[model samples]
Target: MDKNLRIGIAVLALVGFGALIYSSNSKQARQIAASATQAPATQASAVGRAIVEVKVPEFEGKAVLGQLAYVAKCASCHGENAVGQVGVAPPLVHKIYEPSHHGDMAFVMAAKNGVRSHHWTFGNMPPVDGITDAEVGTIIAYVRTLQRANGIY
Candidate 1:
C-alpha cells in the first residue's frame, strides 16, 4: 500500500480504539451511579416503643470475607488481630465498635473513603484503594465477629 494509505489506516485504528475505551468507561460510570442510587437503607432508629429500620451496609454472612479484607487493608494499622497497633490504632474488638455504635455504613464509608480521626491522635486515615465495596462489606462482617467474640454482643 502507499505510505499515505498506511498512515490513514493507522489513524483510523487509533480513533476506533480511543472511542472504544471512552464508551467502556462511560458505561461503567453509569452503572456505578445507578447502583449507588439503589443502595440499601443505611440507618435505623427507635420510634416510641417500636424499632424503626434504617438503611445501612449489611454484611449478614460475609464475616469471614470481611476478615480477609481487614487483613489486607486494615491490619497494617489496626493490628493483625484487631488489637490496635500500640498508639497507631484502636482496639476494634470492644463494645465501642459494636454494630449499634459503629454500624456497617460507617465502616463502609470509612473504607471506601478515609475517616477523619475525631478522637484519635492518628489524625486522618488515608484512603485504602484497590479494595472494592464488596471487600469493605467483608471487612465489616469480620470486625463484627471479632466484637462478638470479645464479649461486646
Candidate 2:
C-alpha cells in the first residue's frame, strides 16, 4: 500500500477509536447523572455520595490493620466500610477508585498533599493531617480490599 494511503488508514483508525472512547465515557456520565438525580432528596445538597453498597469481606493481615487505620482516619468522610457519606465524600469502593484508575500512589499523594477534585463534585480534598505515608499505604490496602469485595476491581 502507498505510504499516504497507509497514513490515512491509521488516522481513520485513531479517529474511530477516539469516537468509541467518547461514546463510552458519555454513557457513563449519563448513568452517573441519572443516579445522582435518583439520590434521596435529603442528600440533594451533597457534593458527592456513595455510588455503591460495599460488601465487607473478612480482613486479614495488613488489611485488618489498614481497616483499623481507615476507620480512625478516613471513615468520618469516606464513611463506614468505605460506603461513603452523603453530604461528605465519595465512596472509595467505587469503580473510579479501582487500582488501574487511581493507583496506590494516588492515595499516598492525596493523603500527603491533598488533591484537586476532578472525578467528583466534592471539591478539592484537603491534606489529611497527621497521617504518615505508612498509614496511607495501609489505608490504600484497606480501600483496595473493599473495592475488590464490591467488584470494583
Candidate 3:
C-alpha cells in the first residue's frame, strides 16, 4: 500500500480502538465527552473565582432520556426527532431554532407559559405537568446531539 494509505488506516484503527474503550465506561461519560466542546459559556463566580459548571446528575449518562421526554411530551405536535409533526411544531434539529434564540431558559418558560399559536392552530403547549427542569435540560442536550449528528451545529 502507499505510505498515505497506511497512515490513514492506522489513524482509523486508533480512533476505533479509542471509541471502544470510551464506550466500555459509562454511557453518560461518553455523552458528556461527545458534547463537551458544545457546552455553553460560563459566567464569573461571586468570589472572583472561576465557577464550576454543573451538569445535571440524572441526565449525566441519559441521552436517550431526553429523546424519551421529547417523544412523550412534545412528539404529539413537535413530531419525533423534533422535525415537526404535520403543521403543529417546527424543526429543532438544526442550528436555526437554537437555544440562543429559543434556548434552555426559553424552553422552560415556554413549557410553563405556553406561547400563542405561532404557525399552527394547535393551541400552545400548556405548562407541562410533572416534568422537572433537569429533564428539560436533558431534552435540550439530546436535541443538541441530533443537531451535531445532522451537521447543523
Candidate 4:
C-alpha cells in the first residue's frame, strides 16, 4: 500500500478504538445511574443518608465494644456516633429516644426483626443479621451513654 493510505488506515483505527472506549464508558455510566434509581428501598435509603461528623467521649468495657460493633454495623445509615440521618434515619442522640419511650429492648427488637419506618422518611430499618443479642445490648449501652451525654435522658 502507498504510505498515505497506510497512515490513513492507522488514523482510522485509532479513532475507532477511542470511540469504542468512550462508548463503553458512557454505557457503564448510564447503567450505574439506572441501578441507583432502581435500588432496593433499604439501599436507596442508606445511600440517601449523608455522612456527618461524629464525636464521642472515651468509653470502657461493653460500651467500648458496643461502639465498635455499632461502627461496623449501624453507622452507615444511623450516622457516626448515632448522630442520625435527617430523612434517612432518626438520630439516636435525640430527646425522643429516652428510655421511657424507646426502651433498650426496642433496639434489640429492631436489630433482630427490623422496624417499619415511622418517625423518619427513611423507609424501614432492616434486620441486621450476624450480630448476637448480647452485641445488640452492648450497642444499646453505647447509644444510651451517648444519649445521656446529649441530654436525651
Select the stronger candidate by lDDT from 1 and 4.
4
Model 4 superposed RMSD (Cα): 17.7
Q: Model 3 clash pairs?
A: 28-61, 99-103
Candidate 3 local lDDT, 1-153, one digit each (tens): 999999999999999999988777546544433332222345222212211121222333556788788778776655566664333354565444555656667777777677764433344667777778878877777777666566654
Per-residue C-alpha lDDT of model 1 across residues 23-117, encoded as one tens digit per residue: 99767755543332232344222111111112223345687677677888988777665765433565566455678878888878877788987
Q: Compared to the true structure, candidate 1 yields what TM-score? A: 0.57
Query: Mind sharing the TM-score for model 3?
Result: 0.51
Better structure of 1 and 2 per lDDT: 2
Instruction: List the lowest-lDDT window of 10 residues for candidate 1.
Output: 46-55
Candidate 2: which stretches are off by over 4 Å? 1-10, 23-27, 30-34, 37-50
Off by over 4 Å in 3: 1-60, 118-123
Alpha-carbon runs more than 4 Å astray in model 4 = 1-55
What value of lDDT does candidate 1 attain over all alpha carbons? 0.65
Clash number by candidate, in order: 9, 0, 2, 0
RMSD of 2: 3.2
Which should have the higher TM-score, number 2 or number 3? 2
Off by over 4 Å in 1: 1-61
What CA root-mean-square deviation does each model show from the true structure? 15.1, 3.2, 17.7, 17.7
Summarize candidate 4's per-residue lDDT along 80-138 as a digit string, tens digits: 88877645566687655689989998899999999986544457889998979988999
| Local accuracy of candidate 2 as per-residue lDDT tens digits, 63-134 | 988999998888888888987665567778877788898999999999899999776656688998999978
Quote the lDDT for 146 in model 2.
Answer: 84
Query: Predictions ranked by TM-score, top down?
Result: 2, 4, 1, 3
